[model samples]
Target: MENLKYMQAIVVDKPIGPSGLRLVNDYPVPEIGANDILVQVKAVGLNRADLIQSYSKYNPPPGSICPDIIGLEYAGIVVRVGSRVVNFKIGDRVFGLVASAAMGQYLCTHSQTAILIPQDLDFEVAASLPEAFITAYDALVLQAGVKLNQSVLISAIGSSVGLAALQIAKLYNCIVVGSSRTPDKLKLAQNIGLNFGFTVESGSFVQSVLEYTRQIGVDNVLELVGGNYLKQDIECCSYRACIVIIGLLAGIKTEVNLALILAKRIRIYGTTLRSRDLSEKIELANVFASEILPLVKSGKLKPFITKVYSLKDLHLAFNDLESNKYAGKLILNWS
Candidate 1:
C-alpha cells in the first residue's frame, strides 16, 4: 500500500437539498488508532440515514469527527492497520459500519466493527449489505425473535431493509407477509420470495393479513410506515406479538389504542442503525460475520443493488434514493 496522507472524499459543505452534489475533494485521509484499521474505500451503500445526515437533520453524537461526509456503511481493502490491530492486515477486503464519513474515499474503522468480505462477493454487493442487513437482522431476528414456522408481517417491503428482512425471515423458515403502497413494487417483492404482499392503498389490507394468517394474526410485525397504519398493524398482531419500528416514512404521529395493546400483550420497539454505541455495533458485526456472512457467501443472502453511481455522481445517487424511485440498495462506487 502507498503512504498516502491525503485522499479524495465527498465533503458536503452545507445542508442543501438532495440535488446539491457540491462535494469537494482534498480531504485528509483518516488515520487509524490502535485497534483500528484504515480502509481504502471501494464503494459505499446509500441509506436513508445518508439522506438525513446530508440534510443536517440527523445529529451526530457530541464532539464527533466529520459529521457531514454522510454515509454509514462501505466496503474496501485495508490499506493500513494500527499496531494493536490483530484481526486484519493490510490488503484484506473488508466491509462494515462506521461512525460517519463512509461516503469518503477512505475511512478508519474499529477492528471489531469491520468484517472480511466474502471471497465470492463483489465490492458493490459488499458495500450494500452491512447497514440494511444488520438493521433487518437486529429487528426481525434479535429484537422481534421471529421463530421458525411463525407468521411475520413486514411493511414497506420494497425498501432495502425490508427486503433484507424478508430474505432473512424466509431463511429462518418463517412465513412472511409484506406490504407496500405500490402495486408494481409489491409484485416485484412477491416475485423475490415474499410469501404474500399487497399495496397498502388496497382497502382490504387488514382483511388480507387476517386471511393470510388464517385470522390468528401475525406473530411479528416490522413497521416501517408509522401513521394511520399503526392501528391497522395493531389489529393484525397476534397475542404477545412483537412490533419493531425502524422507519417513519409515512409520518410520526399516530394514535394507539392502549386497551388493545394491553389486551394483546404487544411489544413495540423503535430502533435505528445509527445512534448505537461502538460496542453494540461491534457485537452486531461479529454476529453478522458468524451467522449471516456465510449465507451471503453462499448466495443465500444476496444483496439487491438496484443502481450504482460513481462518486462524482453523488447528487444523482442521493436524489434517486430520496425520491424512492428504486427498489433494493443503491451503491456509490469510488472507482
Candidate 2:
C-alpha cells in the first residue's frame, strides 16, 4: 500500500435500484488515524443494511468517508499500523466492523475494533463473523443478559444474526426456539442446535412457542423482524421477559398491546451496532475478543455463509441479499 494512489471498490453510483451498484478501480484509498490500522481487505460480508443504504433508505453512520461505498464488515491483513497503535503490526490477520466503506480493497479502522483472526478461519468465514456474530453476542449476552437454561425466542431464525444467535444461545444451554417464514431456514436453524423451530406462515408463532415451553412462555426474545413480530413476541414473553429489538425488516408500524406489556412487566430494548460511539464499539469488540473468540477459534461458533461471490459479481450479491432467500451471510471474496 506504500505510495498507492487509489484502490478498487464497489460503489453505489446510482442510488435508485438494486443494480445501482458498480465497481470502480479508482476509489481513493482510505487513510489511517493515529490510533487506526490500515487493512488490505480480503473478503467482505453483505447485509440488508448495505442494500438499504444504496437506495437512500438508511444512511451510513456519521464519520463515514465513503457513504456511497456500502459495506459493514471485512476480513483482511493489516498492512500498516498507526503511530499510536501497538497491539498490531503489518501482516496481522484481522476482521472487524465499520459504519461504511469496507467493501473496498483497503480500509482504515481503529485498532481496538479489530479482532485477530485465528489460523482456523479463512478470510471468507472471518469476514462473515464480525457483523453477525458480534451483533448477536452483543445483543444477547452483553445487552440482554441471557442466562443458562433460559427460554429464548429469536424471530427470523434464518437471518445472519439469527443463525449466530442460535449458536450463541446454545453455548449458554438456553432452550431456544426460533421462527422463520421459510421452512428450509427453520430446518437450517434446527441443524445448528436450535431446540425447536417453527414457521410463521400466517405471521404468528406465539402458540408454537407457548406449546413448546409448556405454556410458560419464553424468557427472552431476540427480535430482528420487528413489525407484527414484536406483537407476537410480547404475546409469547414470560413475566418480566426481556425482548431486544435489533432490526425492522418487516415494516416499522405495528400495533402492540401496551396493556399486555404492563401486565407481564416485560422489558424492551432496542439496539444497533452502527451509530454507536467509538468507545462503545471498542467495548463490544473487547467483549467479543475475550468471551466469543475462544468458541470461534475452537470451531464451536462458526459463520453460516449462504454463498460466496467474487467481487466482479457484485450485482448478483446485491440481488441475492435483496431476495432475502438466504438464511446466512453472503460473502464477497476479494482475493
Candidate 3:
C-alpha cells in the first residue's frame, strides 16, 4: 500500500438486517496483491444477498476482503495497480463483482475481475449491472441455451435480475412472458418489450403463461421464485425446456412430480454467482466483457437503476429493496 492510509466503509456493526449497517470513516485501505487493483468506489449495487449476509443468513466464500461488509458489486476508478497487473492502470474506470466488502471508499480485487466501463455509461448505472446482468446472462444464455425466437418465462419480473433477463432474451429475438405479484409492475414490464405479463395471484399465472404460448408452453423459464412456483414452472415449460433457478425467494422445499419432469425432458439448473471460485468468476467476467459489454456500449443493453441513495442512508435503501417497490436495482452512491 502506498501513502493512502484510511478509507470509509460500511461495517456490519449489528449484522441483523438493514438497520444493522454502520459507516466507519477510518477503516484501513486494503492492501492489493500483485495481480490485484485497488478501486476507488463510485457506487455500489444493493442485492438480496447483501441483506442475507447482513442478517448472517449467508456468508461469503473464503478469501473475501471483509466478510462482515455487505455488498457484492461495485463500479469505480482504478486508483492503484499492483506490480504484476497490466490490464488496468491508474485512473481507468472499471466495474465488476466482488464476493464481499465492496461497499466502501476503496476495494481491491483481481485485475481480471474488473472490466473497463463504457465511456458513456454512468457509474451509478454501471454499478447496477454486474451482479444482476452477469447472473441473468450466465443462467439464461450460457446454461439454459436460450436461442433466437425462443420463448421464456421469468418469475418475479420486477427484480433487477429479472429485468436483465427480459432485455437479454429480447436481444436474442426471444419472446418474453413475465410474472409479478404486483399488477403495476407487470404492466411496466410489458411496456418494455415483454410479450406478455401475468399478475401472479394464488399461482394462477401458470395458466396465463400456458395460454400466452397457445397451450404449447414456453421454451425456458427463469425460476427466480422457488417453492410452490417450481411445480407451476414445470407446468409452464414445454418439452425439452430448461429452467434456471437463480433465486429461492419463495422458500426451499417443494414437491415435484417426477413423471412430469421425465415426460417433458425438462432440465433444471440451480446457480449462484457469488458462491463460485475466483477462476470461475474471472472466466465469467471474460465472457461478459466480450459478449455483453459491446451491447452495453452500443446502448442495446443497459442497467435499470430504480433508486439511488448515499451510503449513510443504506438502511433505507435496503428497506426499499425489501419492499419490492422498485422495478429494477437499488444503488448506493459511494463517491
Candidate 4:
C-alpha cells in the first residue's frame, strides 16, 4: 500500500434513508487481505439495496469492509494488489460487485471476483454492468439452467437486473414474458428482445403468461418482484419449472400457496451476490468474463444506463431510484 490513506466516501450516517448519508472526506482507506486488490474507484452503480441499506433494511455480511458506505457495484483501476493475487496487477482497469464500501474513491475486494474491464468499455458503463448482469446471469443461467427455446418470465422488466435477464434469455432464443406497470417500459423490454410483455396492474400476469404459452406455462422465471408476484410466478410456471427470486421490490412477506407449488413441482430459489461465498463469486466472475462480456464488446449487448451523476449529485440519484420510473441504472461517477 502507498502512503495515501484517507478517501472520500458516502457514509450512511443513520437508519434514515438517503437523507442520512454523509459525504466524508477523511474516511480511512481500507486495507487489503492476501487475496485482495485495492481499486481506485471511478464510478458506482446504485442498486435498490443501497436505498434499503441506508434505512437499515439490508445488511452486509459480517466483517465486510466499510459496511456503512452505501454501494455494491463499482468500476475502476487497480491501485494495488496483495501478495497472493496473480490475475490482476496495478493500473489494470476492472469492475465487480463487492458487499459494500463502493460509493467512494477507493475500494478493496477479493481479486478472484474482479473482472477486467473490456478495452472498449469506459468506467461508467462498466459500473452499470456488475450488479445487474451478474445477478441475472447467476439466477437465469447458473441456478435455473435456462435452455434454448425455453419460456421465461421476468418481472419488473424495466429494472436494471430484469433487463439484463431479458437479454440473456434472448441469447438462448427463449420466449420471454415480462410484466411492468408502465407501458413505455414494457415497450423498451420488447425492443430489447422481450417476446410477450404487458402491463401488470395488480401484480397478476398469470393469465397473460399462460395464455401466451398455450397454457403450458413458462419453464423458468426470474422473479424480480416478490410479494404478490411470487404467488403468480408459481401459478404460471410449467411443471417442475424453476423460479429464482432475485429481488423483493413488491415486498417480502406474501401469501403463497403450498398446494400450487407442490402440485406443479416448482423449484424456488432465493439468491443474492452480496453475501455469497468467495468460491461462488469467483466462479461467476469467470463465467461472466468468458461467456457474457464478449457480447458487449461485439456490440450485441448494450448495458442500460439511464444517466450518470457526479458523486456530488448522489443525493439526487437516490431519489431518482426511489421513483421507480427509470428504465435502467443510475450511475454515480466518482471521478
Clashing pairs in 1: none
**Which portions of model 3 miss their true places by more than 4 Å?**
none
Steric collisions counted per model = 0, 0, 0, 0
Cα miss at 59, model 4 (Å)? 1.3
Top candidate when judged by lDDT against the true structure: 4
Q: Candidate 2 residues 172-199, lDDT tens each?
A: 9999999888999988899889899888
Candidate 1: give its CA RMSD in angstroms: 1.7
Candidate 4 lDDT for residue 297: 88
Residue 320, model 2: lDDT of 85
Per-candidate alpha-carbon RMSD to the true structure:
1.7, 1.2, 1.3, 1.2
Residue-level lDDT tens digits of model 4 in 1-335? 57988989998887898888889999999988999999999999999999999898897889888998889999999999999999999999999888899987799999998999988899999999988988988999999999999989999999999899999899999999999999999999999899989898874678888899999999999988888899889999999999999999889999999998999999999998988888988888888899889988887778999999997787898988988879999999998
lDDT of each: 0.85, 0.89, 0.89, 0.91
Per-model TM-score, in order, reads: 0.95, 0.97, 0.97, 0.97
After the best TM-score superposition of candidate 2, give how far the Cα of residue 247 lies from its true spot, in angstroms: 0.9
lDDT of 1 by residue, 10-91 (tens): 6556777575435666777876789888888999998887777667777566644466666789999998899999999899
Residue pairs with colliding backbones in model 3 are: none
Model 4 alpha-carbon drift over 4 Å, by segment: none
